[model samples]
Target chain A: MSRIVLEGISKIFGSKQVEGVELIRQGKRKAEIAAACGAVVGLCDISFDIVEGEILTLMGLSGSGKSTLLRCMNRLVEPSCGRIMVGDVDVTRLGRKDLLAFRQKTFGMVFQHFALLPNRTILSNVGFGLELKNVPAARWNEAAMQAIELVGLKGWEAKYPHELSGGMQQRAGLARALAADAEVLLMDEAFSALDPLIRRDMQSELRDLQQKLKKTIVFVSHDLDEAVALGGRIVLMKDGEVVQIGQPEEIVARPATEYVARFVEHIDRAAVMRAGQVADRSAPVLQPTLTVAEARIRIAGEGGDAWLVADDDRRFVGCLLAARLAAARPSETVASLLEASGEAVAAESRLDALLARVAAEGCVAVVDPDGRLIGGVGSRDVVRALAAHSAESQAGDHPETSILQQTAGAERWTGASRNFPSTRSATKASTGSPTMALG
Target chain B: MLTTALVAVPPWVFIGLAALATYRIGGRKIGLLTLFGLLFLWNLRLWQATVETLVLVSLSTITALVIGIPVGIWFALSRRAWRTFSPILDMMQTLPSFVYLIPALPFFGLGAVSACFATIVFSVPPVIRLTALGIRNVPTELVEASDAFGGSTTQKLFKVQLPLALPTIMAGVNQTMMLALSMVVIAAMIGAGGLGRAVWQSIQRLEAGAGFEAGIGIVILAVILDRSTQALAARARPHGAA
Candidate 1:
């Protein structure tokens, strides 16, 4: 179910007046001075749904209205037009009292600046949100302490924001959001200000937290990599409008427009595509009585150099020797070559895992439910997939899936393991598929 | 020299104590520098006179701060009141100290009260400015964060703004106190006892030794007060101590 929804939202500023009007000459249009400031369409016709217990990312360059859209979600900056629904409530139409209550109970936000009170200790800062909500002092502190511990800042509660490093301060900000216990978390460039190493660590930590807490999150970022890594779906924005929205792989494979294509142009595709995308499904199956020479011919005909020797029940017994296929006699199963083997990966495994497996095994094979070889993939294929995904992602031809989808798909591929061969030529031919490769 | 010692010792003792307290609050460098300044005053033979000057300055500074901080906080909290009083504050800051004596002498009859009144007026600006600046500079994001969490205006001000503003406010207090000290010495011209009186007496007799002794004493007191207050300010900061 969608936990939050924004429909046909638009924000226009200074809509009425042109430039170079003197205040006296402008007269009462001066009272409409806001209208004279020139129209800035901060967000135009933006619409999306954030599913319950999912991480949705808004991705855009600076001035693209990603942050503005996030702000409008909570009425931090009121939208000129739109209906924003948090559950059954039309948040855009909320009165001041209702808005305040909604902000306290329904949403929590984290900013890029860490937004911690410089004067307060880490504990106090963390508890600040709860305190505002009128939680009793005792209860607030307890909740704050738990949040601090969650962020790995157990012993540093008494320290002030200035005493901590930038990363620690951001953690405190996260703790503050956690303490609030709101249903939805809104993060605006929260990790963008951190050093690269710290940002990566925080991203993993946030993922772990999300796994455990299952809170709905809407994160905003300009970096495509970040969005792909942490978001379940991505909404790409440009010049106050949504350019595309989709799973990371879909976007990478087929960007919605040229603008999106430019954004994804530099991304590595291998990191974004699943092993299933490039895995060959036509590996040869060996019979129990097949000779090594016969097996070799069968394997070659199937476009594979290896054959799986499985028993009648389809239990993977061993691999077949292609060179000795002709000498093998009947009743002599290929299971003789079934020495201890490395682990096989599912076809759906992400490219990152696939790469790791290839690195560990020098080659990886994709296997089905019965342990039958579906395809083989190597390091080179992973790289190729990444490149192809990036090229397609920039084109922005695919708009069905939001940017959140692309991010989530990218993350899955980068984190899972699978087997496939390096099909550079095939990848080139499939220019439409987006590759999200982590370089 | 003996008379100089008598006058200088009391103020130096208090000044040293204040400096030490400030050092404990601020840091060691300020403490050491304050001690060095006291030593320089002793070398000038004005340590005793300076000590006497310190007592009046301290009293006046305390009085000003007591009145100034609350007023500053009130002004910060209320736009209407601040607008009403802003011009008054401006006038107070711009008015000459000597002008205060014309009215103060007749009302208070030329004594410690008169001197203190003049010193208070002179020292109020730093306290007010610092307090306002500190509160204003408190991060808007933090304020918003607190509000989002459910904090009331009182909680936001006390928990977020005031505490953060302490360091800057303390700095203002330090400046005010220093300014007060200088004013107290000037106030001594109007029968305000202390180092300023001693300097005045020596000048009347054309006794360079007595004047120098009193001047040195005042310098020592200044060093002690300055260091200690700075130390206190530093120590009160959220980052350094906690």
Candidate 2:
């Protein structure tokens, strides 16, 4: 379900002015001020849905209005024209008192500079947001302490900001956000200022917390890699408009635009696509099968190279491989050789998770959430995804379908290729039988 | 000699106490230096006149600080008050000290009160200027941080800004005290008894040794007061806790 929505949001800045001398020269009664500071269209016609419990990253360079867009979500910077709906409430139209209440309950913000109070200790700074909402001092303190512990700053709660290291200060900022217990978290380049090592640590910590809390997060970052690592769905932005929004793999494998492709070109795709992409599927039918050796030969001869071992109802029981038939015993079911293919199948996983899954499974299969196969992928898939992504990226044009098409052509051959009759016959049959080709 | 006793004891005694305070605060080397300077003035026999001058300077500096700090706070909190009073502050700082006696003597009799009044007019500027500057210079980001944390106006001012501004304000106080010390000797011309009276008496008699002694005592008092106040200011700083 969409937890938040922005529609037709636009912001323009300027005030009208009058020029008296010009008016007098023109023989006018009044010289009116045109809205002449020259309007700055900070955000123009921006609309998107952030699904519940998803990390939707808003990625763009400075002056690209990513920050402004994020700020608009919380009404920190009001949009000149738009509607922002969070759940059932229209946040854009909130009055001052209602807006304060909305902010207190709906969102917690983490900024680039940490913004911890210099005079207060870490505990107090973290509790500050809660304090503003008028939480009782004792309750807020306890909540703030838990938040501090959550961020792993348990022993350092008494220290002032100046006494802490830069990373610790940032952690305290995270703790402040956590303490608020708001439903939506807004991060504006929250880790940009920290050293690289600390930034990575904070990113992982945020990922871990997000997993546990399931809060809808809108993170803004200029770094594409960070976006790929953290975003469940990325909203690539340029010049105050959304360029693309999709799962990281979709952006990496099939970027919607040149600007998006430029971002995706550098990403490693094997790490972004899931195990289901390459997972071997069970054959559709169940038979009173022969010995494993006899079955392998018969299936190979019939052009059904991979065989499924299923119970009577045709439920997927296990898989059998042609290459392993010699080692199989007659009494042993195919389940013995079904070696747990550790590949992740989800298409929405990040590059880091994809990489980890690929490394674990040797090659991951990409699949939809229902466990239906989408495509087979290997290390070469990662290379090709990256190359195709980058090739079109370097061309700085529309989506690079040709490079991906070429790579897909190269990877079409497998151990099962020998079982299929002829490419010409297969092509002819594919034209008439789409379901057969899919199977 | 009796007149010398009345004039000399206060400046010399006060300076001696200041030298002791500096030695305690700043340690041995500064203490020895302060002690030697005091001894040099005593040897010159101008210590009596110096004591009298120290009394007037001390009185004026204290008075200026008391009046200046509240006005500085007012200026810091209210922009309108600052804008209105800034020109008056400018006038106070730029106006000549000598001109103060012209108007002051007519209202107050020629003695400690009139001399103190002249010293206050001359010395008060540094304290006020520094206090205002100190408060103004506090980081705006820090102020915002406090505001974000839900600090009330009073809490923000007292807890965050005031403590941070203290060192700068003390620096101003130190400077003001230095100016007041310098003006006391000049104020002696208005029949304020002090080292200045001794110098005047010595000059009338053409007694070079007596005048030189009184001048030396004034110099010793000046050094002691300046050094002690500087030490105090330094000690008041945030870093001093370490």
Candidate 3:
């Protein structure tokens, strides 16, 4: 179930909000509404759901209302008009006292700056929420110590905020939120201020922490790489409206608009696309017990230099090279001709990690956790995916694609597709019955 | 009562108490130097007068801080209250110390209490202004964080805002004590006896050597009070509860 849902949320920064809201309902864009009523639209009818225990990233360039939208969740920056439901409660209608309690119990917030009280020690800062509620010192201190240990600052709890490095300070900030044990965490550009290497470390640490804690986290970031690193669904915003909402792979593969296409122009597809997504599921699956003569007939109409051979249970045995199969005895089993050169990777492995394997082996098989083959990722399939991604991003000026093009060996890979020998080319022509007849 | 003690107490006892306090606050070197300076004042025959000035300055600074800190806190927490009271504080600060003494004489008559009253009026502004500035200058982000964490208005004020603002407020207290010390000589014009009376007597009889002795005695008292309070304020610096 969706843990938090925002409906028709709109925030106008200036007066004439009534008129501004009316124009927004009439489908006026931010600038048009601003010109018409002299009220700046901060969020224009923004709506989305935050599923429970998912790290949903609200991503955009600065001034795109991503942070504003995040604040709207806890009503820190109240939405001008909307219905916000966390569980069954209508958060928009919560009174000051009730809202304060609800926010304290439900939402934990981490900011761009660490925001640790400079006067307080790390332990006190972490336990600040509990101390606010007048919890006994023993209980709050115990909770604070646990959180500090969780963030790897166990001994530093007695130190001042200024004594720690920027990264450690942010860890303390995160520990402060964790100490409260809130069901949801709203992290607003939490790692953006850190040095790049530390920023990456924090991202991974957050990812690991979220997995263990299972907190419904809404992360806000301007960097797409950070969003992808968090490995969550992303809601891309532009000009106070959601542009597209999907996983990084879906968004990169099929951007919903030109604005979104431009936003993802420099995204490293290898990092976002998983091995499963890149695997060619249409490839013929050969049975291990099938005769070499029968396997030759099965792949004769296909365009692969080799076929992934799997048993009846779809357990991947190995690959059978076409040349090796052709040289074998007619009565020999396909398993007997199987080549050990092919690599098998977990389906969840990222495409960047699979690229080196792809370069080494002509094709790599993608398997589930149980080691059952899902499909194969060949050089042609990778080249095709890269070409499509580059073409989409090429609508804008993407200078970074030169690196990908070089690494992909664009000419050799693309030429391999066009000038492939006909003997191994079958699926492109005899698509229907021939391959199925052998099966 | 403090005046009676100053008159009855022996010179060595006063120096001994001061040295102990200075040792606690400013550490050994400063404490010994202050004791040496006090011994010089005793040799100059100004110990009684110096103690009287110390009593007056100490009493007035404590009173000013007690009154000024709360008023500053009230101003910091409420914009409306600040707007209303800021101009009055401005007027109190701008009006000369002698002008305050003119009104103070009729109200309290010529005495130590009247001198304390006038000196407080003269020195209270720095504490109030600085305390308000400290609270007001607390980072908005920390306040928002406190609020987000469910801290009530009172909780935030005491636990987060005030604690964070202490160093800045202590700086104000230091300023207030210095200002109070400066007002002591002027305060003596209204028959408030202390080092000021000793200086006043020398000026009247055209006694240059006595005047110089009393002047140096006041400087010595000022140094002790100034250095001790400054040391206290420095010690009070918020070091993350460490």
Cα lDDT tens digits for candidate 3, A1-439: 3399777788889677788877766768899987887899998776666789999999999999999999888888878876788999988899988988987888889999988987779999999888877789999999999999999998999999989999999999999999998999999999999999999999999999999999999999999999999998888888888877777776665456667767887888789877777777778999999998888788777886677889899888888776787789899998788777776888767888888877666678889878888888887778766775665445454433432353333333323222211221111211122111110
Please report the TM-score between candidate 1 and the true structure: 0.72
Displacement of residue B149 (Cα, Å) in model 2 is: 3.2
Docking class of 3: acceptable
The whole-model C-alpha lDDT of candidate 1 against the native structure comes to 0.70
TM-score of each model, paired residue for residue? 0.72, 0.71, 0.87
Which residues of candidate 2, in runs, are more than 4 Å off? A1-36, A39-56, A67-109, A117-144, A158-163, A179-186, A214-218, A232-247, A253-257, A268-322, A325-336, A340-347, A350-375, A400-439, B1-137, B189-242
DockQ for all models: 0.35, 0.17, 0.47
Best by TM-score: 3
CA lDDT, every model vs. true structure: 0.70, 0.67, 0.82
Q: Write the per-residue lDDT of candidate 1 for residues A1-439, one digit (tens) a residue.
A: 3388776666665543233122212222222443545445566555666779988889999988888898888877777765788899988777777788888888889998998876578998898788777789999999999999999999999987888999999999999999999989999899999999999899889999999999998999988888777847778887677777666766665556667767877765555666766553444556655655555566664432344555565445544433444456644545555435745677656667677656655446666766766555655455545544553455355533433345443433433332332212212221212221100
Candidates 1 and 3: which is better by TM-score? Answer: 3
Query: After TM-score superposition, what is the CA distance of residue A423 in candidate 3 from its true location, in Å?
Result: 43
- List the candidates ranked by TM-score, beginning with the highest: 3, 1, 2
The runs of at least 3 residues in candidate 1 whose Cα sits more than 4 Å from the true structure, single-residue gaps closed, are A8-37, A75-81, A92-101, A117-121, A131-141, A154-169, A280-302, A306-348, A356-439, B1-59, B70-95, B102-114, B185-213, B240-242
Q: Residue A275 in candidate 1 has what lDDT? A: 70
Candidates sorted by lDDT, best first: 3, 1, 2
How much does each candidate deviate at the interface, measured as C-alpha RMSD after superposition?
Answer: 2.6, 4.6, 2.4
Instruction: Please give the TM-score that candidate 3 achieves against the real structure.
Output: 0.87
Question: What TM-score does chain A of each model score against the native chain A?
Answer: 0.78, 0.74, 0.84
